[model samples]
Target: MAAPLSLRAPAATPRLPRLAGTIRQPLLGAVAVALFLLSWWGATASGMVARLFLPSPVEVAQATWRLLGSGQLVAAILASSARVFAGFAIAALIAVPLGIAMAVCGPVRAVLTPFISLLRPLPSITWIPLTILWLGIGETQKVAIVILGCWIYILLATHEATRRVDPLLVRAARNLGAGDLTVMREVILPAALPGILAGLKVTLAIAWSCVLSAEMVAAHNGLGAMIWEGKDWGDMTQVLVGMVAISLTVLLADLVATRLERALLPWERHRRH
Candidate 1:
């Protein structure tokens, strides 16, 4: 007989490096962004771009730094943020309950569905003329703009998520003696939390966009107004600085939303539960 077969199975490839890569990639990306900004600054400082239109990175940084050092940045941030929050809060307040009620009640759903269908596709900007007519160029107008911008998205998200709550879960809740309020609170909300929260994230971002639209019309004090003023004055550095500030604010808002989701979805966090 030939020598006994001595072949062995191939060893498994290591997964640690792949796992590490997942974490390393974002870190590398962040580092790359910082490096890019640094290089951009160097180029600008060296007069790579015309100062009028494309201000040197250093000039933009200086403008931003000065704004930050003063309270102007803070005031603009607060004003824009307040508009966003007020509008978003109003939409959420109305949408969530309305969505749940409509999903659970056919007659109510029939009554409202037509209106939501008609209104949702109309751009928020389209409402600006009507809103200004109704609310005028005051805080009311700004809030209305934000509201019009965000309301449809919030309503749709809430309605769809509510409607799509798993039938099995609803049945299970009924079988277990859960009532409407309890079922909604315990089963439906939890089940739809992820989707609803996801919608909030989207709406919040849109709220940011809407706030800018609201601010640009005639607001004396907002980041949006700041940008417009900067442009009119040919202060490209300030304009770019405003853009950067908005971007940073959006990123920070995303971070807060993520943390809020993680905190609220305890069952999601603990999969075993």
Candidate 2:
């Protein structure tokens, strides 16, 4: 405080760390993955890891290459992707309207809540027995499982979001000569969109998992079937590759959803920092 050399000394700025925080986790993750692969290769070579149970990274890579070249993997991937899209789209279409209806019609929500609560906890696999009996073991049944998986999650999310949207916005809209439909369109939907999108993002991953499970039986082609067949033959390499593909696919989907959320919810984002 005593050393005032200049009338206007420059403001001091904190120096940035040598490593950026954003990339620190990614770098660490890469190193950890590399070490895991090295250890896996060593264990397989040393006979500590049985080939039937655990395959080397190189073996999994070779299996992936072979599946790709054979075109079987392509067919499986396409079939699974199609089922996922169809089911997920149907779920969104159904859930959004139902959620809105529940929000607007209090009695309707009260009536449905109990039934939905009962069903929501049930897993997609549990529905297989009933679905098979109700519907044939075909694309419809497979798609149904995915829809069942997606619908409840989106519905609950939408309902919660709608409830969370400020009531003052609705009152303001009504004060300005807005009808119920107008209020919903102008206030409720827009306000709840971010949460709804987040729910959809979560459901997309669930739908993928459901579709894989659905493909376990009766499906001639799909990633789940491929994995099942691999397991039946004790081909751990192929099983590992398929599992990796599924995980990577879900991660890519999550990334896309995050990007979409960022694009759509820019206002919420700006408020954060």
Candidate 3:
């Protein structure tokens, strides 16, 4: 009987050699960074770029080390991280549900679409003036700024993601006797989640920018304050150090987010593999 045609699903094809593939990205990133540092050193060394205007990478690294030793860097990182977490957490809580509502309910989408369209184009920095006026430059103002900067985009992205969930899946779930809530909870959410997570990663980056703008205007201890202080003093090394610190912090956040996405969507990972 031809060996009872295989009943199991076929195994997924393996990707390129695992060890090599795993190391390749970081290795290339390291090489690219090395080349950038070399070019930076060359520019400063040859006097093509004045040190006063753009300090050497070595000088910035030394300044970073000194800040690290003095505990200033740690303090700034904590402060900035807290503000970002608070703001982003709030935004996500607000946006995700509302976004799903907008996606599923025509009336809700109609009501919010106009507002989102009107506000989304305004940059994070513009909100600084109004936020300061209302919230008075405290931590509240900073967190609010981050919230405004992030929530709208996240809501819109979530709406789009949720709307993209296959209509057939919804129909199937409903036919199987799933109610609206159950259909949404089990079918829509799982399908929409991958896109929502991707959007959150981007929105988190925007949150950082918003916090920086907020801190620059009226804060004392965040990375934005550090940058503004260095600028005022014309300490290129300090300025570069603050910039590098922000970049590194964002990079770390992005890495964490990428891992989280892989964890939450294992099927996506397997498909990619």
Candidate 4:
């Protein structure tokens, strides 16, 4: 007798395609990096580029090792990381609630929209002169620069994310006897969270850039300070090492943010697969 179609087991999902996709992405990235290094090494070896102007990979690696051994690299990392964290935390604290309020309340939006628009167009670097004048080249100045550079973007992003939340969800929550705070907490926030997270990831990167810029101009110690000192002394290798350090730090931060996002929005991960 023929078995009923509904009762038959579903066809087994193929694992090979998923496995290949997982392997392919990193494999391609590794290949590209290898090729870039090979080209850079070739250029240096053939004397196509002056070693003083652009140090070879080997020289840069040696400088990195020396910095690591002397603990200067670790010190710079800590200084820069401290400023970044302090400023970013303050920005997040102020921006999130204020942004949500702006989105949910017309009076708040009308008051803040013009201020945000005026500041949003300014670059982080442009504030350096004023910050130095106001804050006097201290750590506070550095932190303030990062705050100014980051908060506007975060506020705008949060406002937009909150505004994008579906009205239907709020209405449904209200229908279910939810109050203003309850609807906001349960419906609007959850719906807006994915966008808010994406914005945070981007704004964190901007914070790093802002702190580095401020450090280069005014600070005595940081990755940016190291880079500036290297340039003054004509040490391309040290400059490259500082640049590499900042890049690695940003990469680590990004990885952490990505993990946090996945943990907060597991549904998005499932949908992607």
Give TM-scores for every candidate, taking all chains together and pairing residue i with residue i. 0.85, 0.88, 0.92, 0.95
A best-first ranking of the candidates according to their TM-score comes to 4, 3, 2, 1
lDDT of 4 at 43: 96
lDDT of model 1 at position 203: 88
Clashing pairs in 4: none
RMSD of 3: 3.9
Q: For residues 176-207, what per-residue lDDT tens digits would candidate 2 score against the true structure?
A: 99998888887998899988998899889899
Deviation (Å) of 162 in candidate 1? 1.6
In terms of lDDT, the poorest run of 10 residues in model 1 is 264-273
lDDT of each: 0.85, 0.88, 0.93, 0.94
Q: After superposition, how far is residue 15 of candidate 2 from its true place, in Å?
A: 8.8
Worst 10 residues of 2 by lDDT: 13-22
Candidate with the larger TM-score of 2 and 3: 3
Residue-level lDDT of model 1, residues 1-273, one tens digit each, is: 799886998889999998998899999999999999887777667777556667767777899889989988888988888888888899889887787778778998999989988888877778778888888878878888888888878878877888898899999999999998899888888888788888889989999888897777768888999898898888898899889989999999999988899898876876622
Candidate 1 regions off by >4 Å? 1-19, 38-49, 270-273
Pick by lDDT: 2 or 4, better one: 4
- The CA-based lDDT of model 4 is what? 0.94
Superposed by TM-score, candidate 4 places the C-alpha of residue 63 at a distance from the truth, in angstroms, of 0.6
